[model samples]
Each structure stands twice: as structure tokens, then as C-alpha cells.
Target: MPIKASTGAAYARVEGIGAAIPSRVVDNHEMTQFIETSDEWIQQRTGIVERRWAAEDETVESLSLEAARNALAHAGVEASDIDAVIVSTVSHLIQTPSLAAIVAAKLGTDGAAAFDIAAACAGFSYGLAQADSLVRSGAARRVLVIGAETLSRITDTSDRATAFLFADGAGAAVVGPSDVPSMGPVVWGSDGDQAHVINMNRTWPEAVESGLPSQLTMQGQAVFRWATGFIADAARRTLDAAGLAPEELDLFVPHQANNRITDSMLRHLKLPDTVTVGRTIRHFGNNSAASIPIALDAMIASGEAKSGDTCLIIGFGAGLVYAGQVITIP
Candidate 1:
């Protein structure tokens, strides 16, 4: 039997799911206007045909608010009922007041514990783990976890390597108490030594003096090697922590960083063909921290995965960081 909360308190389980994909769809052909890439090349390489780009009015907070509202609505919850709010992102530039504080104010969730986490693409998993701990520890009754990003704001649209990869979006989940722990503990770590594999070319202060945009830069080959080589073991470790086997998973949702990465991990795990895999990158691109939740939302929307189904999610990114967990669909 699964272990019950030692405190006799309820454990955290995902109660609601939501996502916001911008209305502006930019296809590869549209990107060809400035870059030297073609639709065929992009599709063959990233398995992405197009992606959404936020409009001028859609700030990170706005996208997060919309997604948070949707999640609360889905769970039959109200913003005022939220006991805590956590926003995960690398795009929101404010350093003083966290994005979570801003989101809570907009949602009327006054006095709620609010903060932001910077885990890059692994953010949602980290947020989930934190929410679980808070709820299980009797610190919060209900928590709103949102992963939002406006990657386009920092991306260089002309850079062929990254231009077609990153985009803007937000995804959220309402986490609450349950009799059993459906949200497993997160397995995560970071390699600060290899952080240079993917990072901004310069700091904001440096860019201000240089009069250049502080765009994202990456050593694609290095990132690919690290992801494919180490992430499979991370997924397995997460499953083991959850008392689940690869064959028991109903779905596999990794960071929509690249289709190839997902494919490689699946093969490494040797999961059965019945496991539904998330291919959200085809439409959403890589929303960084938002990727896993958005992919989870997509699976829920398409009727591919349903409540009670076990899904494995893995998130990896710029800090050369990674996090994975096994969760029951809500």
C-alpha cells in the first residue's frame, strides 16, 4: 500500500489544470522572411511546424492570470480560496517583488504566501514538489502553481538555432489535499559546472552598456548530449521513487524542448507502445518552465490521458538542471 501522510494530514494532488497558448501562431515559413531556414529543415530537425508568440499586450503576468483563472475554474475553486501561489519563470525580470506576489494581487488572493522559483524548464516539477510538501506538512490547504514564460521577449528572432525553438505561454495547476499522495516526490538536480551549455550571451547590465539585446545563446550539441545521456536515468529514478515502473505509466510528458529528446528517452526506458507521449512542441514550441504543464494540459484536452492515469513528467534546461516526477492525472 502507498504510505499515508505521517501527520494524518492530507497529501497534495493536482485538482485542476489549465494553459494559455498565445493566439499569434508563427509558422516556419513566416520565420523564413528573415532567417536562412526553411520549413522542411525546421520540421525535420525539431519536429516543430509552428509555435505561438504572445501579443504586445500579453505580459507574463497576464498570461499567468488567465491560466490561473482557468485552473481555479476547472477545480471549482476561487482565487480568494487559494492559500498560496507559486510562479515559476526565467522571463519575468522583476527582482524585488516576485511574480507570484503580482499574480496573487491580480487574482484577489490577498495574504496568501506568494513567491517565484527560478528552475528554468524544471520549474513546474519543482513547484509541484514544493506544493506537495506544503500541503502534506499542513502549511497550506490549497496552492496555485503556475509556470509562465515570455521567451520571445528575450529570444533573438533572427538566430536560426533558437529562433524557431522558444516561444511564449503559461500553464497552471491547482493543488489540494487528497487521501493519498498522487503527486510523487520530485527527483531533481543541477550541474552548475556545465551551465554554459545554454545561457544568455551577456548579463542585463552588460547589454545595457553594449547597446545590444541580451538574447539567449546555446551550445545545442552540448545540451543534446547531456539531455539524452542523463535524463533517461532521471526519469527512471523518479518512477522508482513513486513506486512505479516504466510500463505502468499511462503517459510520458517531458519538457517540450525537442521531439528527438523525448523520443530518445522513451527508447531508453523501453516503455510499452501503449504509453501516450506528449508532442506539444509541434504547436506550443518550448515555453521553458511552462513546457511540462502545457504538455500535460494538452494531453488532458485531447482525451489522451484522464483522471487517475499515471503520467511521468521530466523537465530539463539551462541551468543544466533537471527534475522528474510521477503523477496521477487530475
Candidate 2:
């Protein structure tokens, strides 16, 4: 259930932000060494020219830890001050212990309630909503929300549909109680019937029996149709929930799934020239759950956005799940 907005209660604001992308860069031209596609083909379709791939030693845990540290430093908070930790990802190598638990341990956040959410690309927004509820309800004073993924590890390089789309990276935010309102109510849901449009072809057990790699499989056309067909209204509802008009927004940080999807959303929402759109996909590809925060961080770091700016963030992905909300940059 959505938490009702309260003027008399404490709310959550993003006090710190950080992002950690892999060192290696894989450009479209370099991809041709292994795949049959060319740079022109990918650019015209996805607007992605390059993406980062995690090195052999880098794992979800490592990336998340670094991002978390950077966020703590930015927030000027110690690890021990965190009351909870939440991580969102679909590409963690191990399914057990939860990526949140591993990250908490690395940060020395002993006994902090920790867990993971698997809402695909919408995971980060989902986490933010949960953190806001916790803070408003007095269940937690501060929450660490991290979206880290290593899609490259599970991507099938030979699969032309997805090879150029998935990449590796992590982004994080420190959510804490604030005197003024910053985060907005969440608008989120899913359509399971359309799950097949983008998903892994085989379950782990099925992959074992079939002797096939447990790689990501996508139906690009179907996903594009679905995204362009649905996400705009969803974004409008998110803005409405915050009592703000489209023209009032300063930034639009939709999930960095594809440039075309982002452009279609811009057209549908009819955002004014004043609203800065996030274009992280051109270089970062789609980092799934991590895309929104990475884009948010990049925007702040580059001076495209700053304190007190109202931003609308949207996340949509596999399970056909999606979530969006309005927030003020910190």
C-alpha cells in the first residue's frame, strides 16, 4: 500500500549519492569482434555507443561496497549510523545471503536490518519507496539503498538482441529522515502476462537439464512496444501523486533501458524544454536496477541538476514490473 503524505511527520530525503561502474569499456565497434552487429546497427536501434563490463575480480558485492562507501562519504554518515540496508539487483551471482546482507557486512553495519529486492529495473525505485515508509513510520532513521548489477556475466554475447544492451555497474543513495519533504509517493505495479517479452529463456534447473548457459534472452520489439505504449501514463500518474504538473519538473530520470524509449516518453509526457532528460544509456547501456541512481548521480555531478530541483524518476523492466516517483535533488 502507498503511504499517505503527511505534513506533520518526518520524511525521507536523499542525503548522499554515489555510483561505481566497471573499468573496462566495450564500444560498439569492439563488440563486432565477437558479434556480427556493427556500431551503426546498435546506435540506430538503442542509442548506445559503449558500455562497461566488470573485470574478472569485480563482483556485485565489490561494486556495491564501493558505491555504499562513496554514498556514506557524501552523506557524511558513518556505517554504524545506518538502520537498514536494501539492495536491488537481478544479476547477483549467488542467490543466497542476499546482496544487502553481504553489503552490510562489508560496510560494518552490524545488526542493521538488511535485505534485497528483485523488481528488475524498477528495483531501486521500489527500494526508495520502502525506505521512505520505514523512515516516515519511525521504523528506521536511515536506510542505505543500493542498486548493483553485473548483467554482462549473464549476457550471451552472441545473442544480437541483448548483447549490446546489458552492462555492469552500481549506484547508491543514502535515505534519511529530513525536516522538509523530498521524496514523493510511489506509483508502481506489474503485468505478469507480458513477462515472456523479456526474460531468461530457462530457469536454473532447466538450464542444467538442457546443458545451456543461464543467459538473458529478450524480445526487443515486444519490449519497445510495451514500454512506449504504457510508461508515459505511469509517469504522469507519478507526477500527479506529488501534486506537480509535468512542466514543473526539472529533471526526468527514466530507466536507461533505451534511448528510443526515453525519447518516446518525453514526447508523450510533453515535457517542456526546461526539463533536463537523463541520457545515461548512450554510455552506460542499461544497468537495470542501477540505471536510475547512476543517471541521478551523473546529473548531479555534471551540474545538469542541483539542490532543490524537482526530478521525476521511472523504472520498468522484466516481470513487466515498473515504479516511478517524484523527488527533490539533494
Candidate 3:
């Protein structure tokens, strides 16, 4: 007798998307109170007018749950339909238990396999790649990928460099079986040699010993160079890998790290003028892993993006990591 083998779907597609933006708005004037910067300077440099910070009542878990629920509802999927959950974030704050497990239970999943990934800003695309693989390999049928962050809690408010660049929010997508190819190959890699470009100022143990919290630090000029030069080429390769021409692309949603960076990439890629670029950074700041998906949901809601539109998405951050792929708007 031959051994039995399990078969999965031929392909997987993003079935739904949702986002949870924190209600507390922190404007440039408010940021100036902490950093020695003016509103015009901040806007001209980063293109950020304001960003959202979580309210006292909002937790990473709560935002994740809300985003997940909204995604499930949008997909017309019952909670029990999700067989796996992936939460991507560096803001979970816990060391042992995973946030994905907690979110899965709260969403009423029937014991879905759950885990978390710490890829900094590239996390959402990283999780989506894993979800796509799992679904196509028969390891899971429906996967929920959530990227949530609360950088406000860890931000060094007095640091003039990064105080105004971080924010808090959550975004999610449901990936399910599809008969056609809906997700393109993921182009991703990291450079440990440049790992110091963006990272924490102290280790946890060091923080505990010194009785002071660690804060994120970045080599701004270095990051700008890497993102604009290498990451821009990577974005072009991602679209090419999907067999999509520049003219065929309907949208571009790069990480909301800086508007200047986005502009640089656009120049490098030379994408068509018809493609709508995501500029949510002006309002949301950089929510790390949550930026891409949040921008996707916002575009869809505002009618800037529509179902079936082809979009190219990418993310890059601490770890000096990067990832990009082409996806059909859900």
C-alpha cells in the first residue's frame, strides 16, 4: 500500500483587509514640544503632519483583536474558519507567550495554530509570505496575518531624531484558498553588516540592570541611502517577478517610514503616473509593521484602491531587512 499524502490549494489570495488606527492624534506642534523642531521643518523633511498614538485604554492585544475581527467580517469568514494566525510586531512586550495565540483565542478561532514574527517593519509582508506558503502546502486552509505596533511606548521622547517618527496602530489581512495566482513571489533579505542602521539603544538585560528603558535609534542618512538605492531596485524586481509591467501596476504601498524615501524610490522605479502611491505617512507617521496594511485598508475605503487592482507593496527597517511582493487588492 502507498502512503497517504495531503494536498493543499493551488494558490492563495488575500480575502480581506482591515485596520485599527489609534484615536489620539499627535500633531507636529505637539511633537515640537518634545523635540527642537518646527511644524514646517517636520513636514518638509518627513511629510508628517501628525500621527496617532494609542489611548490609555488601548493595548496591542486590543488593537490586534479589533483589526482581526474587522478582517474576518470583511472576508465574510467565520472565526472558526481560520486555521492559523500570524502576528507580526516588535511591540508585543512579552518574552514567552505569543501575541498571535492570545489574538486567536479572542477572535473565537477553533484552536488555530498561532505564532509571532519579529521582523520589525518588514513583518507584515514576511507574515504574508508564510501564510501564502502554509496555505499552498496544506499546512493551513485560512490564515490571518496581523501587524500591530505601539512604538509610542518605547519612543525616546527627548530624542530629537526619532521622537516624531513613531506611532501606534494595527492592520490585518485574511489569506484563503484561491484557484488563481493572486500573490507574487516575495523578494526579501537582510544585511547584518548594516544591522546597526536601525535598532535599540540598549539590550533588555542592560536596561534592567541600569533601571532604564531601551529606545529605538537609527542612522538616518544610512537608512535613506539603503532604502532609496537597494530597496528601490528590490521593488522593481518584485514587480518583475510577478510578470507585471510598470504600466500594469495600479498602486504602490511602500513602508511609511519617510515621504522623502518614498519619493526617492518612485524616482528610481520610474513607475507610471497612473499608479496611486500611498501617502498615509502624512497622517499616520510610521507605525512599523502596521503601515503597509493600514495604508491598503485606507486606500480601499477612500476609493483610491479598488478590488482586483494590482499593487506592489514593500517594507524595510531594523535588522536592515527588506521584503516586497505584488498582490491583488482584496
Candidate 4:
């Protein structure tokens, strides 16, 4: 049986958001050494200027731990208060022990249940929805959701499309209870039918065992097609679910996938540039799941978002998935 709409779920609000970027910076000019694309062409398409790269010694566990610590401090919550830790990622350094488990151990919160969620770029959004549910169900009071990835580790510098598009970064957000519905119902969907549109299969054990090149690859145009229509649909559904209208929004924080895709979705949704916050992918490339929250943190700090301000966070990619939620600052 399907759950009916209009159930009175408890309100779940975001307490804080923190982001971490590796100290290493890789700029566009450096791409000339490996790929045929020029800095200008890449920038015109993806809006990436400089992206962070993990040090060779960096591990997914360490990055998530650092990001989680910053978010916990900003929210004034102790690690012990967290009921669970959810990690969203596609680029963990290893395949076992679950990155979330390792993150909990690092934060001294191992008593909390932890798990990993793989929804590709929509990972953080997926994690947020799960966290919200946990809180509303009285199962958890506080949840830590971190989207961390070292995409550069699997990127083939020779693959022009991927080499210039992916980088490394992490973002964490703490979700807890609040008076009003600070975060709205999320509209999410996945079409495994298009699974190959954005693939990361090279790193599979069998592929590695067979001595095949381990790298990340994507069908840029195919993903662009999915992003444009699916994201617009997600935004519309989220607004409708919240019983809100577009004109009431203060900002829109979208996954920093590509400049062209964002522009297309905005056009399709009839939203003006003023309502959207651009992390300027030209500045950080695509951090995948971390992109939306990274942009949200920037919007809040810049005063584009404030207490009582309403906004939307939408992300889509590599699950062949899309998710959108209307969030209000409290």
C-alpha cells in the first residue's frame, strides 16, 4: 500500500552546513598536458575554473571526518548527540568497512548507526531526505550527512570530458527538529534505464582484476539532456508538494553539474538569475553531491538567504537520479 499525502510528519530543519576542499588546486591550463580541450572551451561548457585535488595520502574517511567536525561545531552539537551518520559518495578510497562506519569511528560517534548511500551526485539530497525521515519518525534527534568524494582519483586525465569535469571535495549538513517545516518534502526519482549516462565502472573489482584501465567517464551530452528536463520537473514537484509557489523563493541552490545545464533548467522553469546562486563551477568544477550544499553555504554567508528565507536545493546525476526540496531558514 502507498503512503498517503498530508501525513503530519514532524518538521526537520537543517542546523548547519560545512564544506571542505583539498588544499591542492588544479586549474584549467594544467589540462593542456593531458587532454585536447582548451581551458576556454572547458570553461565555456562547464564553468570550472579551479578544482581541489586530494593529496595522495588523503582518504575518504579523513575528508568526511574533517567535514563532519566542522559542521558539528557550527551547529553546536556534540558528536555524541548524533543518532546516525549517513555518507553520500561515489569515490571512497575503498569498497569495504563502509565509509560512514569509518567516519563515525573518526568522530568518536561509533555508537551511532552509520551507513553509506550511493545515489551519485544526488547523494547529499538523498542523504538529507533519509535524515529528515529518521527525525520525523522519532528514530533520531540529530543526523549528520556528508557528501565526500575524491573524483580525481579515478579520473583519467586523458579523458577530456571527465578530466575537466570532476574534482575532490566534501560538504556536511546537520538536520534536526524545528518549529516550522524548514525543509520541505523532497521529490526524488531514479531511472536505472539511463544508468550508463554517467558511469564509474572502471573501478569495479573485476575490471581492475582484468587489468582494464580504472577511470571515470561520462556521456556529457546525455547527462545534459537528463539534467535539463528532470531537474525542472523536480523543482516543480517540490514546490507543489510544499504548497508553495516559485515567486515566494529567495534562492535556488542547484548541483554544480555544468553551466549549460543549470542555465537550461532555469530557462525551463522560468526562474531569473537573481533567484539562483551559482557556485560558479568555473571556480570549483563539479564536486557532484557536495555541489548543492557548497552553494547553499555560500548563499547563506552572502546574505542571499536569511532566517525565514525560502529556498530550493536540487541535484541530479549518476543514479540517473534527481531530487529537489524546498527549504526554509529558521
- The true-versus-predicted C-alpha distance at residue 121 of model 2, in Å, is 0.6
Model 4 collision count: 4
How well is each residue in 1-330 modelled by candidate 1, as lDDT tens digits? 998654524678999999888888999999898589999988888899998989988989999999999889878888988989999999997776999998999999967999999998999988998888888887888899999999999999889778989989999999999988788889999999998888988888999999997878888888888888898889888889999877889999999999988888988888999999999999888899888888888889889989899999989998988998888899
When summed lDDT is taken over every stretch of 10 residues in candidate 2, the lowest stretch is 4-13
* Candidate 3 weakest lDDT stretch, 10 residues: 88-97
Model 4: per-residue Cα lDDT over 117-193, one tens digit each: 98878999899999999888877888999998888887887886788889788889999888677888889999999
Which prediction has the highest TM-score against the true structure? 3
Q: Compared with the true structure, what per-residue lDDT tens digits does model 2 show for residues 1-330?
A: 999753323778898988998888999999998689999999988899999989999988899998889888988999999989999999986889898987898899967999999999999999999989888888888899999999998899988788899999999999998888898899999999998887887888998999997888888888898889888789988999999998899999999999999999999898999999999999999999999988998999999989889999999999999999998898
Tell me the whole-model lDDT of each prediction, alpha carbons only: 0.89, 0.91, 0.94, 0.81
Error of 2 at 297 (Å): 1.0
User: Which residue pairs in candidate 3 have backbone atoms (N, alpha carbon, C) closer than 3 angstroms, thus clashing?
Assistant: none
TM-score of each: 0.96, 0.96, 0.98, 0.93
CA displacement after TM-score superposition, residue 166 of candidate 3 (Å): 0.7
Alpha carbon lDDT at 294, candidate 3? 95
Off by over 4 Å in 4: 1-9, 203-205
CA deviation > 4 Å runs, candidate 1: 1-8
